[model samples]
Target: MSPSTSVLDMLSITPPGWGGVLITGAFATLFISFGAYLFGMTLGLFGALGKLSGIRPLQYALNLYTTIVRAVPELILIVSLYYAGTDGLNRILALADFGPIEVNGLVAAIAVLGFVQGAYMTEVLRGAILAIPVGQVEAAKAFGMRPGLRFRRIVLPALIPNALPGFANLWMSVIKDSALIAVVGYQELALAARVAASNTKQYMVFFLAAAALYLVITIVSNMLFSALEGYFRRGQRPVA
Candidate 1:
């Protein structure tokens, strides 16, 4: 194929065996990030609350969790989790007399990435929670609001507006981190590009296409985040 035709053909997301692979990889990247972000956020919400809980042990434990995850390199975490984590999980299942579970690559990718992302999310949420006016919470308490009610009615809403910027950053990081899991055999965009380039010897074309796809995701994410930030910012006092 001519250079122009080769580039054009490889970029096609339509039929022919190779064309759709990278496109599918791009979607897999998005899927992993979505799962990781949600999982991370769940861990983060609890971690943040634990840090602020005034229980020394809880604070210590969360501090350790975030500290360890943050201190390690992401590549190491991915490697360690893929090999050791799966084995450990299966071991536990075996002890429980349950069938051995094969860890799916996509699921492992999300879990590994989410495990790392959660530490960062913890700090982000803890700061957002701290930024909430203490008086507001106290007032709710004085009104006989239960802790759950106070958080649900007063804290969470206020936190959303403040938390969104941090969440946006975390989300972007998650998308990029999705590439890391490709090392662990998750056929995300990076892996997809590598395979295509390897097969076609069109290194520049496939790699650049992967770059463009990543940029597209980042751009789309920024636009979405801008809309969300605006939607939440409307009723708030201006950030100084």
Candidate 2:
């Protein structure tokens, strides 16, 4: 038996078919991270806008939201929210006379991710927005441009250059943090590794494979973000 064939046969013998489970787990991890990033972007945008509005009460509330979320450890938040979220939702459904429903770990993880990461993203976007020249915004307004038009034409274009790098960093963080979802029973890459190890009693093998898989993802993400940043920076000169 060839070495390659032996490896394949061993994988096939596993309950999840090592190849299938690992591949699926990778996708799941990516999907969870990506979905949460998108969600966080939306939440962060609102938070940034609220902060920038300069309303003292609103700013204080938004700041408090970010402060509490950022201070807490992500793993504790995920596990706590998973249990509390399930109970809270189920009770609401029961009260509504609807059938009880269970929240999937993936769903709970996404919520936790959005709550936590969105806080950080808010500051990133806020700083990006602040980096834009206030003079340009005033000039736009002076040009008879409406508030919406000024934002669409000047504000968005100006801040995007600053925001992209921050977004890339946030994206990478999300990918790594998705592993924590395993603690909540989301069965992502790390959880899959644990299961595969337990089933085959080949702890070293499965762990090494999981590590390789995560490394591949991180590498691919870095390359992708580099390409994106390059594309965005095509015509730009660096500031001194």
Q: Which candidate is the best by lDDT?
A: 1
| Model 1 ranges off by over 4 Å | none
Candidate 1, residues 186-230, lDDT tens digits: the string is 799999999988988888888998999999999999999999989
Q: Which digits, one per residue and each the tens of the lDDT, describe model 2 over residues 1-240?
A: 786765565467355458668768888999899889988999999999999998999999999989987898888877777788888999999999999887777777888787778898999999999999889999998899997898899998888888998999999899888999988778888898888878878777778888898999989999998898778777999644
Any residue pairs clashing in model 2, and if so which? Answer: none
Q: How much lDDT does candidate 1 score?
A: 0.90
TM-score of each: 0.95, 0.90
Off by over 4 Å in 2: 1-8, 11-17, 94-99
The all-Cα superposition gives candidate 2 an RMSD in Å to the true structure of 2.4
Sliding window of 10 residues with minimal summed lDDT for model 2: 8-17
